[model samples]
Target chain A: MGARRLAEMQVEVTVFATLRKYLPDLPVGGSKYIKVDPGATPADLIQILGLPADEVKIVIRNHVITELDEIVEDGDRIAFAPAIAGG
Target chain B: MTRKIVRINMSNQKATYEDVPKKWAKWGGRGMTSAIVFEEIPPTCHPLGPNNKVVIAPGWVTGTPAAPSSGRTSFGGKSPLTGTIKESNAGGLSGQKIAKLGLAAIILEGTPAKDQWYYLVITKDGVEFKDASDLMGKGMYEIDEILWKDYPKTAVIGIGQAGEMKLSNAGISVNDPENKPGRYAGRGGLGAVLGARGIKAIVIDDAGGPGVDIANKELFEKGRKNLTEAIQEHALTKKDGGLNAYGTDVLMNIVNEAGGLPTRNFSAGQFEGAAKISGEAIAEVVEKRDGKGMTGHGCHPGCIIQCSNIYPDESGEALVSCLEYETAWALGANCGIDNLDIIARMTRECNDLGLDTIEAGNSIAIAMEGGLLEFGDAEGALKLFNEIRNKTPMGRILGQGVEATAKAFGVHRVPTVKGQSMPAYEPRAIKGIGVTYATSTMGADHTSGYTIAPEIAGVSGKLDPLTDEGKADLSLAFQASTAFIDSSGYCLFIAFPILDIQTGFEGMVDTVAGVMGIDLTGDDAIALGKEVLKMERLFNERAGFTKEDDRLPEFMRYEKLPPHDVVWSMTDEELDKVFAWVHED
Candidate 1:
C-alpha cells in the first residue's frame, strides 16, 4: 500500500517570448500546458525536457523559491525568463 | 526647406524660432542637430551651465506615416559623463510628433529656479511655459499618465526623481501610446538638465500640426517605397517574429555566444548564466507560467518593429523589459546577478527614476566591488536604485557616474573610459569597438563605432574575432557610417542590410534627398559622414580633450579577458592614424 494506490500528481510549466523555441509544440497561448509527475520539481522537469538550467535567468513561483533544492507541488506554475539582449 | 529651429537661451530664457539652413535639409533628424551643435555651439562651454544648449531633433522620416519610423530623437549636450560632447538618441513618439510639427530642432537653454516647476507646451497655439507644482517629484510614469489624461492626444516628455538631483546618469522620458512613459532619451544625463531647469514635463499639443512639407511629392513617394521595401526584405523581419514580438531582449544569447557579452565590470566576456537571462528564457516563462504577453508591443505610434518587452517578476508580474543586452549585462553579469526578473525590476526602477540603465548598471557593479552589496543580491541593487530617487549621500555617489563610484569605493578594477562607464561589449575582446571607445568624443560607448557591424554582419571578410590589425580602419568606417545612419533616423540595425548591399544605401539617399528637396549621391553621403565626425571631434578638441584622452582605460591593455586572452593592442599613434580620411587635403 506504500503510496502505490494513489494517482500521480502534475506540475505546471510556463514559457514566454522567445523561449518557445525550447518547446515549439506548445501552442501560441498558455494551457497548451504539459503534464509532469507530481514528485518532480521545475528544475527536474526542465532537465527531463532537456532545457539547460544555466540558460534560465528568471524563475517565477508563488513564494521564495530557492535554487534546485526547491520542490514543486500540484497546481504550482513555474515561469522561465531568459535575459533580453537587444536595443 | 520649410523647417524651423527653436533656439532657447537658458541664460535668459529667450527662445528663437528660426528657419533651418538649406545645407541641413541634406541631413535631417539626428544628423541635422548633431551638425548644428558642432557648428553653432562652441564645445568649450560648461555642460550644466547656461553656456551649454541641448538640441532635440527628429530624423528626416520621423514625422512621416512610416511604420517603425517613430524613433529618432537626438540630444546634443556637453556631457556630464564625458566632460566633452555627448549626443544620444532614443526610440519614442515625442520625436516623431514634435518633428511632424515642422521643427528641425528645439534647443533648451539655461536653468530655472531650483524649487519651481515649469512645463513647456508646443502646438499650433505656440510654445508657452506653464506651472507644474502639482507634478513635481512624481515618477515619469505617473507624470506622463496625468498629462496625457488631461490633454488625451498630446505627447508628453517628463523627468523622474533621479533627474531632480542632477545625477550624471539621469535620462529624459517620453510618454508612449500605452501610457507607459517607458520611452526615454536615456543617456548622458540630459534629464538632469531638465530637472535643473525646474522643468518637470513638456506637453506637446500639436493637434492641428503643420507636418514637414515634402518639396517633391513624386520623389518622396518613390523614396518611401524603397525604404519600406528594403526593411521588409530582411529575413529577420519575416522569420524572427517582429522585434515587436519580444523587443530587443532577443540579443542576450546571441551576443553571449559571440564572446563579446560583458560580465562583472568586464572582468569576463561571457556570463555562465546568460542563457537563463536571455530573450528566449524570458519569453518562455512569461508565456507558460504567467499566461501574459512578454512582448510589450510598442514604444511609439506605428512602430512595426516592437523591440520592447515588459519584463515581468518571477511570479509573472510586470516589471520593465528595457531588457536590453547592455542593461542585462551591466546589472546581471557585471554585478554577478543572473536573475532576469530582478534585472527587469531594476530596469523598472531606472525608468521610474529617469536614469540610464547602462550607467546605473556600472555604478552598481562598482558598488558591489566596494562591498556595499554582495554578488547576486537582487535586494541590494533595488536598495541602491531606491536611494537614487531619494538622493542620499551614497546614492549621489552612485548616481554621479561610474568613475566617481569607483573612486569613492577605492576600486581599482572599475571599467571606465574618459570618466564614462564602458558599454556591454568588452573592450579587450572586440578590439574594433575598443578603438571607438577610446576615440569617441562621447567617451566609452558601443554605438560610437560598432564592430558588431563586421562581427555580426560580415561586411568585410570575417577575421579572427579578437584581431586588431585592420580594426582601426574598420572602426573608422563604422564610426563614419554610424554617424550617417544616426542622422537618418533609421534604426542602426538597418546597417546590417545597408552594409550588406547597395539597395539599402539607395533607399536611404532617396529618403533624405526627397524629403529635403536635394539630390544626394553616395559620395555626398561619405562627405556628410566625414563632416559629422569632424564636428564631433572638433567639439571634443575645443573641450580640451586631445589624442591622449582618446585612449581606453589603462587596465584594458593589461587585463586578459577570459576565453580569449585578448587586450586592447592599438597604440595611440595607430588610433590617430586610423581616421586618415578625415585628414585628406
Candidate 2:
C-alpha cells in the first residue's frame, strides 16, 4: 500500500543538506521537483528518492518536518533535512 | 588601564561612549557586565521595552594569548525569557574581536526600525550598522557561514527561529571552534528580544589594518606560556576524549551513575539510557560508526578541553554530540527518550531553530504528562518541533517555554524555580545545587553552583559528593570562586587542579595583569565577584522578586529520588544564610 506512481500524487519533494549527494541529479540542498510516488509512505519516498532510509534524519511537511508514516496529501511540500552534527 | 564602554542608545540613535569606569575595570567578565546592568538599567522597566539595555562585554583577558580565555563573552539584559536581569556567557571569537576594537562593552538600546533588520559590525577601523535583511530568517549556522564568508576573520553572533518566535527558552548563538554559529548563550530567551528588535547579527572583525594594540608584548608571552602549560598540565584538560571528543554528552551517564541526573521531567534522578547518551559513548560511536576525526572538538579557538563533539551516525549522517549533560537530561531522560539519534536530531532542531534544549526538554516532558503524546515517543516530540518548523498552534505554545508547557499540560509538578527549566542535576538528589538552582540570578541554573560537590568528589582530592555536610559552605565558596574563574574567561575546568592552590587563580590574575600591564591581585578578583553577586541579587530584589523567589520547587524538597531516596532538606533560613557576607571582608 505504500508504493505508487510518482506523477499521480501531485506532491513535490526537497531533500536538504547531505541527502543531496544521494539523490538523482540532486539540487545542492536538495531537489525542487521531487514528484512523490503514489501510495508511498515517507519511508518509501525517501528510499525511492534515494536517501538511506535508516539515516533520513528529518522530514518536514508544509514547512515542518513530519513523522515517517505521516500522510502526504496532494500539493504537500515535503522537505527532507539531513542531520548535521555541529557544536 | 584598559578601554571604556560604548553605549548605543537606540531611542535617539545616539552613542554614549565613555572610559571604563574605575569601578568596572576592577571586575571583568560576568562581574563587570552585571555591575553595569544593575547600576544603569532600571529594574522596574519592561524587559522587552526600549528602557531595557543589552550589554555585551569581554572578560578580563578576553583578547590575551590565554587558552580558554579566548572566547568567553558576556551579555547582560533584562531577559524576555526570565523577566529578570540575565547575564549569560558563552565561548566564541566575538569577545576577542570586540576587545581588539578597543571597546570593553557595547550597549544596544531601544528598538530598531521595524522594516529594516540591523546588526552591529565592529572592525578595528570602527563600528557600523549593516543591512541584515538577507540575513534575517536564516538559521544560526547559515548566519555564521554567510557572515564569515562575506567578512573573513570576523566572529558573528545571532538569533535563530525560536528567538524569532520570542519563545522563553530562546538563546543567542555565536560561532564555535569550527566556525559554526552553534555556540549559544543557551539559557534565557534574550534571543527573542534581539530578533524582535530587528537585529539579525553582530559582526566584529580585525579588518581595519592595525589590530589589537599590545600594551606589553614581553609580558604577554610569559602569561601565554603559563596558560598553555596550565591547560596541558591539568588532567581533564590534557585529554581530548572528554569534551573535545564527546562534548558534554560524556557527562550524562556519569551524572546518572552518581545519582544526580534528572530523569522523566525530574520525577527520577537516573536515566535508563544514560550510557548510550554519554560523551564516552558518543566518541566510540563517532569513531567506529562515522569513522575518523569525528570526535569532539573545542567550542572556541585554543581550547584544550575540546570536549565538544560532532557526532554522525554509522551512515556518516550527522547527529548531535553537543548533546550537553543538561540537554541530554532535558531531551533524553526528562522526556524518556533513550534513542541517541532522536536526541541528536532534536538537539539540532533546537539549535537550528534556536530553542533552549533544557526548556524544550521540559516542555516536551510536560506534553507527555498532558497526553499530547506518549513518553519517549521520539516522533511525537519531533512533530512538536515540526509544528514550530510549520508554525502550528501547538508548536507555537510548546515553543513558548516550560511555564506555558506546564500550563497547557495542567502540570503542577514543574521542576523549575524561576519560570526557567532546571538543568540535568536533580536538586533533591544533589542537595547543594538546590541552593544554586534556587538563588541564581539566571534562575534554576546548575552551573551557577553545580552541586557535583558530592558527585564529582572534588578533583584535587577525594571528598563525598553524596553528603550534605559542609555542602552549603562548599556551594557558596564554589559560587564565589567560580565567579572569579568565569570572570577571567578561563574555562571552569581550571578549578579541577587549581581550586585549593593560593596561586592557582593568582596565576590567572597575574597573567591578565602581565598581558594588560596592570597590577591585578587575587583579592581584587574575589572582590569583583562579590560585587557582581551583590548586583545580581539587587537586580532580582528590585524586580519584585525577593527571598521568596530564591527557593527550590516544592517537589524537590517533598519528593524523594530513587537510589538515594532523598529529598532536599536545607531550610529557607539556612539557604538564605549561605549568601551572608563575612564581617572580615
Candidate 3:
C-alpha cells in the first residue's frame, strides 16, 4: 500500500525544554497524541504544530535520537527538544 | 600589572611571593596547576602528607570584564580518592578576585606538627593567618555565614566536617554570589588535602587591587566580541534559551527518553519517575512555589548564559542554589528516589558537609545495594549524611565514596573508574562518553570531555549515541579542546557555541593571545591542552597507573543496561588508541 493512500495514524508527541513554549496547552514533559497522515515524519508533525524549524533541533523516535525526516509509526513515542546541552 | 605566585607554608605560618617564571608564563588554570603539581610534588607522595601541595590558579581570561563567564578557578593536587594527579575547577567569585589581586597562583604546602586550625585573610596589603578554633567542625554553610559577617564581600574557600576527617569524598567549597557554599572543586578529595594542611578557610578581598592587564586592548575586545556574539546567538546558550530557561537539569527528560539516564545504581537505563525530578518539573515547581526560586541565575559574575537556578520548597523558600543535572541523576534516579525536594535536601547536605554530590549519592546507592538501606528510601538517604556529619564509623565508610562503600558492603557492581564514581551519563548506553570516562585523567568524570553535545544534543552534528566507531578519536578531540577551554578560564558550557561556530573557537584562542601579547593559534591552544594532559598522565604513570587502569568497571563489560540493553563493548585496543601520544618518547 502506498503511504499517501494509507489511513491516518496517531503518534505520541512530547516537546521538552524551551520547545515546550510551542505547545502551550500540553504540560512540560507531558505527551499528547497527534493524528497525522500515514507518511508523517517528525518534520510533518512539527509543521502541524507550528513549531519554528529553527527552534526544534532534536527529534527522538521510540527512545532513539533520530533526524526529523524519519517517518513516525503508529503508537511510536516522538519527542522534540531544543538545542539543550549540559553534563 | 605584575602577577605573583603566593606560597604559604603551614608549618611556620610564613608567606612568600615569587615572580612568574618564563616557562610558566603561558600557563593558567588547569595548565598552571597541573604543571606546578607535576614539577613540585613527588609522584608517589602520600596525598595527605606534608610533601603534597595544593595549587590553585585561575584561567587565562578570568577577572577581566571583557571575558564573559570567565570566573572559574582550578585546584590541583595528588588525589587521595583516585591516587592520581587531579585538577578540579569550580565557578565562583574567587577566581576573578584572585586574578584582580594580581596573583597567578597560590600554593599551600606542609602541615603543622600540632593539630591547629587556621584561616587566612588575604587582601592587597598581605596575608593574615589567624586562629580558627571557633569555626572548627562547623558546616560550610555556617562557616560562610560566620566569615562573611567578619569579612563582608569577600569570597570564602573552605571545607566542612568531611574535610576535617580527611575523607576521600571531601570537596573544597567555593561560595556563590549569594554566599551559598554550593559551588565546588568537588572531585578527587582535594578538600581533604586542604583540611590535612590544617587550613579552615581562605577569605579573599580583591577590592582596591590591580585588575587584569590585557596586552592588546583592541585585539582583546575584538576576540571578546566574537566570543560573546556566539554565546548570545546560540540557541542553547542565548538569553532565555534552554540553559537560561531551564538550567542544566534540562537534559533529564531527553536523557531519560534516550534510555541513558542511569537508575538504581546503574542497574537500569531509564527511570520510571524521571519526569518528577526533571528540569522542566523543577521549573514548574519553581513557578508554583513563587517564592525565592528562579531560573537564569549565573554561578559567577559576567556569565551571560546563566544555567544555574534556585530550587525552592513548599513554603516558597530557597532549598538549594542550583540543582544540576548530574546531582539530580545521582541523588534521584541513581538511588531510585524521584522527589526533587528530597534531592534538593541531599544536595544542601552535600554542600554543607563539603562533599561531592556525585560521590555522596553513589555512596548512598552503593550502601543501598549492599542491603544497608533499601532503594528509594528517601528518609534513610537523608540520615546517612548525618553519619558523615557526626563522624560515625558507618559515616566514615560512606564519606570515602562509592568504591569504598561498595567494598564495605561486598557489592560487586561497582561503577567507578580510577576509584572515582561515574557521573550522570551511562556509558553502557552512550558509548562515546564511556570512552572519555574510562580514559579521563581524573576518573569517570563527565566534564573531562563532554561529548554529550554531538551525541545527545545534536549541537554540531548528530552522532549515534550507541555507536563506538571512531569514538576514541572523538573523545580525544573533545578532551584536548576541553583542556584548552578549562585553561582559558571560561565555563565549559561555552563549548556548546564554540564547537558549532568556527569564529567562536578562533575568538577563544585570540583572547588568550590578545591577553599575553603573543602569537597563538588554535593548534597552539590544543597543543597546550595536550601538554597539560601529558603532564598529568606522566604523573599518574609515575604514581603506578597503567593501561589496565584505563578500562571500565568489570560489571559493565558483561551486564547489559535495560531499555537499550547495551554493554560496554569498546575494545581495549580502541581505548589504548586514545591519548596514545602520551606514551610516545
Alpha-carbon deviation at A60 in model 1, angstroms: 31
Candidate 1 C-alpha error for residue B104, in Å: 0.7
What TM-score would every model get versus the actual structure? 0.85, 0.82, 0.98
User: Model 3 chain B — which ten-residue stretch has the worst lDDT?
Assistant: B576-585
In candidate 1 chain B, what residue range of length 10 has the lowest lDDT sum? B235-244
- lDDT string, candidate 2, B213-268, tens digits: 44666665665666566655653445542344455554564456556677777777
Tens digit of per-residue lDDT, candidate 3, span B389-506? 8899999999999988999999999999999999999999999999999999999999988888899999878899999998999898889888888888999999999889989978
RMSD of each predicted structure: 9.2, 15.2, 1.4
- Two-chain DockQ for each candidate model: 0.10, 0.01, 0.82
Model 2 misplaced stretches (Cα beyond 4 Å): A1-87, B12-16, B66-69, B209-223, B291-293, B317-321, B460-463, B500-503, B516-518, B582-585
Scanning candidate 2 chain B in windows of ten residues, the lowest lDDT window is B453-462
Q: List, residue by residue over B1-585, the lDDT tens digit for candidate 1.
A: 378877765445556788887666566655776777777667776666656667788877777766235366777777777777777887666777787778878877777655666788887656777788888778887887788777777778878888778788888887766667677777788887666666778787767778867666677677667656665565333225425455565656555555677787777777888767766666666776674446645666765555666666666666664577677777887888887777877888888888888899989988888888887787778778768777789888888878889999898887777778888777777677788888776788788778755554233335444677887887887787778777877666666545545776677777777776777887777677777888778777787877888788788789987756677787788888755555573
Candidate 1 vs candidate 3: the DockQ winner is 3
Error of 1 at B213 (Å): 1.5
**Ranking according to TM-score, highest score first:** 3, 1, 2
| DockQ order of candidates, top first | 3, 1, 2
Candidate 3 Cα RMSD after full superposition onto the native fold (Å): 1.4
Candidate 1 C-alpha error for residue B1, in Å: 7.1
